[model samples]
Target: MARRSLPSLRPTWRRRLTLALRGIGVLFVLGLIGLIVAVYIQKAQLPSFDELKSSPNGQMIRVHAADGTVIVSIGPSYGEWLPYDRIPAVMRDAMVAVEDRRFRSHIGVDPIGMMRAVKLAVANHGNEKRFQGASTITQQVARTIFLSNKYDLGRKSREALIALAMERKFSKDQILELYLNKVYFGGGAYGIDAASRKFFGHGADHLTLSEAAVIAGLVKAPSHYSPTADADAAVGRAGVVIQLMVETGKITPAQAASADLKRVALAPEPKQNSVRYFTDWALPQLDTLIDESSRPLEVWTTLDLNMQRAADAAIRANAPAGAQGALVSIDRDGAVRAMVGGTDYVTSNYNRATKAARQPGSSFKLFVYLAALEAGRKPEDTEVDEPITINGWTPHNDSRHNSGTMTLRTAFAYSVNTVAAKLGQQVGFGTVADMARRFGITTPINTYPSMVLGTSDVHLIDMTRAFASVGNKGVAVTPYGITKVTANGDTIYEMQVDRSHVLVAPYVAAQMTDLLQTAVNTGTGKAAQIGRPVAGKTGTTSSNKDGWFLGFSSGLTTGVWMGRDDAKPIPGLHGGTAPARAFAAFMKPATANRPIEPFETQVTLPEFQLEPDQEFGQPDNGGFVDENGNPIDQSAQPPTDQGDEGAQVDGDGNPLPPAGDGRVAKPEKLDQDWMDRVLGRDTPRNQPAPGRSPQRDRPAAAPPPERPADRFQDSRPTQ
Candidate 1:
């Protein structure tokens, strides 16, 4: 039977061929139907130009100065985004020449191009990863708008289908324009227009042929070929684009050669704001004015660039070796104009202006004087200068010698330690601390007796803020940085001033200002005195551990502090020497253009009066007087002398009577008595008496104490 069938095998082959042709025909019809459905679905999902325009999902980050100079940028948002007519002809030709030479001839997909790419990729044994990108211009646009950075077969397939849909809906020119506007160009630039400004500080229309080639090269690997990111790589890629242009006859060989010689002129890296000090102080206040999600903030700060530079230079110039310093300047409206966190930010990141905790020294005396004035005490009120011990603690003046009598104003102007301490004691310690807190001190203050001497710690920012209150005329206004924030021309935030509370009466603040003026004119803060009217205080910590000068004029208030990070005492440095000098240097140039305004004098009411001068020698009731007007005991006792026994005196220096009875008793030896007094107990068995060596004799006293060896043994035993 098989031999019989073999005789007609040729005819059987024909029958099989007919059946296979029918199967192929049926499959081709189904494939056509499926492709039509796919095309319809893809077109339905495609975004329209109007939809893209109204989408809020995209955002642009732009930074501008107060005067509208663009400082920096981060993202993109907008349709009709391209200056289409303004695009350079060279750039347009180069892009098509390098990316898609036959872009005008293809219908979003090129079978010939795909075949060539497949052949090259196979020839390289899969090692040449970038053998070819067979995608048409339309396909590239689809990938840029809808695909992710991930490289996978599924994404490529989706991009191809989308490109087919786009080719059917838009013209070749429209597709090319969208592709150019949608691609990334690194350096935080998202389009050709943005890239032009980022790399050349110009618009797309003005880009040179070489620059256009460089930008077109970045489409394959933006970061790798970005001029700012990698100049050498970008130049090499640009050379390839130029060669492609030459091969395509878009540019002559001479033009390509000249283009190769052109170098990339990238804009400089943007300058950092360097406003850390002011930002830290203003952060919380800004939070209250705007929500956290606000974008493109237009922070119309009070910062004057000139003043900030002057302050920074002055701080560096006046800062001593191995010492750090901070300066903050605010206006009368409580707006911070300038701030420097330290002498060198690169050396240390610690923000001394808002974070360093140190003693305020004599500057704290201002609070004491303010409290005294509020309690009906006049600056002219006289107080006697005598050592007065309170609860076993005695404070002394810096001179170690007190004036017999002085006015309150003179005492404060001289920063008399004893007088300030005495006045602080008279007013409650709690009262002074409360006053400081009201003036913006947020640090914890210990109400110990030493608080009178500024033993409390405070940040320089808080100190500067408190001093600004004086200039604000008793109204304490919080400082802020960001003024308003808008995104895509929509206002999202507007800064508002948050005035919390009234700290003091206007007249009281003015009186304090008047007293502080005397400090600048004749006291320790004399170095801070400028041509303009100013009031301020100078501070020097114990052993010169810290130096500070804080002052305010009618328009500006400033604080300066200098010290070492280790808290070690600085040599030959004081508040007046370094900090005051810096303050004056900064203020002189900062206030040069402002009007010279004087501090207002304190208003006197009918309740106040001036007392007549009393006789100097008279025991006055109005002035400070102790139980007796003679004098107060203000002496420390010295150690008594020990004399030997059998000592006698001649007639010229004769021995006197023990009392008025004229009894000339023999002088007793003082060795045992002196030893007992010095030791405050019986002498030890091994100890010697006065004028007697231990080797010669042992005094009659208790035996020396002993310790147990076991109790003194090391806690950790050796292995």
Candidate 2:
């Protein structure tokens, strides 16, 4: 009785429908209020419209060579900022036709485009990969200026709110200006002007219809459809943009047909990207020179395009198979004229010139000799070139046998390891290391006896710079690339020429130059001789893992390195064989523009007379001596080819017989260095040759050549 019959609890269908509709309507109102609040919050977090208007579009750094050739353009590249009226009408129409057809009628966000995007997303089962975007040009401008490319409901809402705010504050023309000036178009280009110049080699103000369409098509996927990356895809995308323009009444059918799709050529790209290595090294220095700015900068560097081209050609021509090579050239004032980091930049951009630190091998002896000379040792002073042991370590000459006692000049010119070791020990290893530091070697150097033979690793650029100091006549120079920097036609920084920094006494530098010249003229670095005058030393590491040739001529200093990236041995790879050859080849052309200049100091080399028993063992005779100067048992040794040791080769690395090899067709000598003396190269000298008796006043044959002594043949520690 208390429960009384419950009245009919079920409502009629019409009533149920009305209740449901009311609930739905309430939820919709709440959602709308929440959306409005979220949008207000997003807009509040964004920059003000005035702040956006004053912000710079982007920052670009254009690096130019000494001759005004563009080496590289770093960062996001922006062109001249044009007003709405200055922009080509064809470009504006193309952008509207392809990006947002209802751009003029919509209030920042287009409802129809959103609905279509939603339908398409649902059809694709919410696949983010295949989802199409619905943002208008206004939304893109807001995102580019105020947001990252994060995809989420919160970001989309903020974008829309920002777009709405922008449209309310600025007119349609202003929005278009912002969009065209701030949008990215791949290839590091930002803004319509930059994009046009990047693809068509012209400014946006001079855009053709087809060119405008090509740029407009890049809005969807800048990188994928970039003309420089994929030309066919770029053309196809441009075709689609043209079709859309025709359908949107921006162009006629006949105009679309005559769009010249095939003629949409891209601006020529740099032939080689190796210049990037130089730019990468030079860009970091800008921070120390000037404060960060939004305006574009023009950096005038010390690079010589012609020298760079010559260096590249030399490396390509001389690098052995299965090996990589790097080169660096600097002027007397320490300006980097050219730098080749590796055989090819695309395959590997490790920047071996500035980054890779490898053992300098015998080339390290430069510091040893310099220390000795500064320590009161004279070139005429004699050192016994016999076997030497230091701290249980033994060093050998490239030929493995001693050349007996010789002048300090002769030992240095020969790159004799024992003499260098003795010199280092006498002058103190720490003193040698100090000398290296004074010469611009920044890497850590071990203060050990082995360091005298170049056991420590160093950068090619640093080594080249050290020689540049010598070339500067004992002046200490900091290797520099950027000489001046300008921003918006205003000078921000200019390199000051300071020549008062001296590293050594002029006499000491002159002596070192004399020794290095002898090395090139009559000793280990004979292959590097350039006919006029060059002073340098060659280095061949233990097991032939690395080869080096560092020299200076005509006020330009250069260093060459050849090796494998893995630090493995290259068979029969001596510094004189390839590295010195490359040096000569590059220097011949690089120094052609520079006038011939003689070294400040010159010295008379002492004559070294060899007894019949001490003669350099002919390649055919059984007169060879072992590492200890003992006669070798030719009977126990394996037989080898009987070709002349002085065989020559053409530019193609093909070998040619010696002049007197008895071959009917003797190939002409490629060069006339000491190596040619083995084939009896004859030249008239006022005085007798070094190895000959002081008797005749006429031309005489050079004495027998030493066994390929221009090498760091091997190194080992006895147990």
Candidate 3:
């Protein structure tokens, strides 16, 4: 029975094979449909040259300095693209030889080249990660148009299908032209023509064989082999491309041997020098000016390249070793002219100028003084010299010596610690802090007694903005770096000065400027004085930790800070030292040609008044007196006033007699009325009285009694 069943099993096998074939056929049809849909999706996303040309956002992104000098850029303009006929044959051959030797023979994708790349990748065991990229010119063009600057399997698959479609649609020459025009050569250049001009200062047609090879070599990794970015790597890679050209017979062996892989001298392009400092500060404001988009826009900033270079140089030259510093300069229009984040931008990307929060040292004193000025205090007002304790903290003068008494002008000029502290106390710490915030210092200030000592933290940018306001004549101008932004010739964003009245009166700013000018001319900021009119202040933190010079001319205001990134004390360095030196050096040249316009000082003071007690009183004979008003000779009397004893006086108002041990006796306490009359309560202690003898009450001499008779007798006998 089993043998009989076996004969029918053959038919069952035929049915099973038929069913399997049907299933395979169905799957194949589904895969074809899916492939067609993917092709349609990719084609829909592919951008044509017409689309690129007509796109409203195709304009290049340009960054300009305050003076309208282009510093950096992205994207390409019409002037950057070139026609195929403009390309040199050597460059065209070199690119084809190195990237795809059989470029003309292949339809779009080079299967042989892909297989070779795969072989090399396998031989290297993935250790040489970047050994393979076998995309042909067509595939590369497709990727550039439809994908991002990233490597992935998804991109590779899309690139393959696009290459096939491109071959069916366009000629080999057209594909090659698009590829040359579309590939990125880094350094902000996007095509062979732009790359040639950027790296060699010449057009593609004029590129030498060696230069052409270098450009072609960059197709693999533009940043890695960019002549401006890395010269040695670029030259090394160029040598490989030249060798490939020789092996492919595109270039003669002799030509390859003669070719020197000379590094092409790149033409100067815009460079971003810690621009993040300014951009980060300007970005938030930019949002209000323009809508967000990936479209390229041109942002015209108020930065002056020369001034920015000068400011950067000053910060670098004066910044402490292993330390970071920041500098910001703004013009009278509240436009930021220059900004520097640190010494070397390439070493550290951290922008210290706008982001770092640091105690401004005495630079913060400006705000305190501004507060006092607003509170109806005159620069010439006299303040007492004495120890003042506020909030359990004692603020000492920079000199650490009691001034005894000083005018507000002198106090601020010398940065007298005691005077500023007292003034801050007079105008409430909260008031001073609030005034500072209104002036652009956003950081919270400690309301302690030391706040007047600039114990509060602030960024250099904010500090510069505050100082710039003074130059703006009492208007607190919100500093803006970017002036305007445009996309495809349409105005998208415009920056205008947004200012507020922080000072009580515009004339008050002028008065403060006068005081600051005095500081530059003959005070602590003497080192910062330039030939032109300059007004500024010097600030040195306790223990010489931070040095700062914040000053301004008629047109520009800048603040500089130098200190260790860790806030460690720098020995023997103060604001008036290196920081001021750098500021003056920069300001001298920057303002040399400008006119010397003095800041307006409207408030005037009357001549200083003299107190009665400060005048000399009538001369009295030098004589000791008793409590009963009896005069006593110094020879017959002992000293009256002893160590640590109060001044002793007799009823006659003369010094009292001393005791037997030669120690002066302590005088009894005088009545309040007597002290008031004698000390001249309303007058200073050093004034002189009218018609008083300048020299009186000094010690008198003993009388000469007689000469020796023996001396006279001896002279007569000799004669």
Q: What TM-score against the true fold does each predicted structure earn?
A: 0.66, 0.74, 0.69
lDDT of 1 by residue, 74-103 (tens): 345322366456678788887898889989
The local lDDT score (0 to 100) that residue 450 gets in candidate 2 is 75
RMSD for all candidates, in order, please: 20.6, 9.2, 16.8
Put down candidate 3 lDDT per residue, 1-719, tens digits, no spaces. Answer: 55544433568788999999999999999988887677667656556655643442234677777667676665563235556777787888888987778788886778887787678767767574654567888878777776665655576777778877777666777777777776777766777877888888777778888999899999888889988888899899989988888888888989988888864566785455766566556656656777756677878887777777787777777666776777777777777777787877767766777888876666777888888998888887888756776765655432223646667776666566677778888999899899888888887777876777677778888888888888778887677778888876687877756555554478778768877876664355645756566788877664455678889986778888877887776654566656776777667666666676767752121111223112111001111122122323335433222100001222211344665654444332112222223323332223323322323111123211221111011111110
Write the number of the candidate with greater TM-score, choosing between 1 and 2. Answer: 2
**Model 1 residue-pair collision total:** 0
Candidate-wise lDDT, in order: 0.65, 0.76, 0.66
For lDDT, the strongest prediction is 2
Candidate 1's TM-score reads 0.66
How far residue 308's Cα lies from its native spot in candidate 3, in Å, is 2.7
Candidate 2 off by > 4 Å:
1-56, 79-91, 106-135, 142-178, 197-214, 224-247, 251-270, 497-501, 612-719
